[model samples]
Target: DTAVSQTPKYLVTQMGNDKSIKCEQNLGHDTMYWYKQDSKKFLKIMFSYNNKELIINETVPNRFSPKSPDKAHLNLHINSLELGDSAVYFCASSPGGAGYNEQFFGPGTRLTVL
Candidate 1:
């Protein structure tokens, strides 16, 4: 079984549209994260959740939201998407807390905004 999985592996939309991507992990990990990979291939952490509680948020815009229904699932919602938001979004999970364990990432969801 996949340790981590994301729905709608690809997303294409206009600049003003709204979209959401869903992620789930079966690894029984306590910490999960949302990362964005930009065109220059720079990976940055957008949000982190531990056991359904928000932990780290890296100054992300209010238009972006991360929700964790439980430890196994974290979802990302983007409203009024912008061109700058076009990037590969990755869902990851780790056994312990942030920076303490190896993270297993899902095959990313590529978002393209026109």
Candidate 2:
């Protein structure tokens, strides 16, 4: 049983292609999020969702879109992937309480664009 899981742990593709990264958590948390970690290891929040509601972070690109089928799942879809998009995508979750809650992260999905 995986607490958090993402498909294609390592994704290598050419520029301009489209790809989707799937994420799921079984922790029964009310909120889930997507984060991007660059080569410098700076973790940045991309999107947050609770039952399909969008809560995006301003730093994220317009090419990136997040979809949540339910409280336990959130997927990322990218359009016209670029070389700059190469990074590690992490799925995380929290209990959805007041204030900032601690997040549990997935193993990560590394995307490489050539």
Candidate 3:
């Protein structure tokens, strides 16, 4: 009964490979998001979806794509992964509203490139 969960706490792969990360939420939230934290620990928003519709897209590489199976799940797929892609990917969710709704983040999936 976790509010938010992500599979494979760590991922390691060679450059040019492709991989994916799964995310799910049980809190009945309407908005879901993906964030990447670099080695500097700067968390940056990548994409956001509300009610299965994309609402925010921060400047990100095209190799990264986010898919929402439903309001409760959002998956991230990365193609042609590069060394630069090696970072901690986090899934988050929040209630869709006008105010400053706090986002609940997953433990995070650390991706390592070789």
lDDT values, one for every candidate: 0.96, 0.88, 0.93
Give the count of colliding residue pairs in each prediction: 0, 0, 0
Residue 69 lDDT in candidate 3? 88
lDDT of 1 by residue, 1-114 (tens): 999999889999999999999999999999999999999999999999999999899999999999998899999999999999999999999999766699999999999999
lDDT, candidate 3, at 111? 100
Judging by lDDT against the true structure, name the best candidate: 1
Per TM-score, the best of the predicted structures is 1
Candidate order by lDDT, decreasing, is 1, 3, 2
Candidate 2 local distance difference test against the native: 0.88
Query: Model 3, residue 108: displacement in angstroms?
Result: 0.3
Q: List model 3 lDDT by residue over 1-114, tens digit each.
A: 788999879999999999999999999999999999999999998999998998988889899999998999999999999999989999999987426898888989999999
Pairs that collide, model 2: none
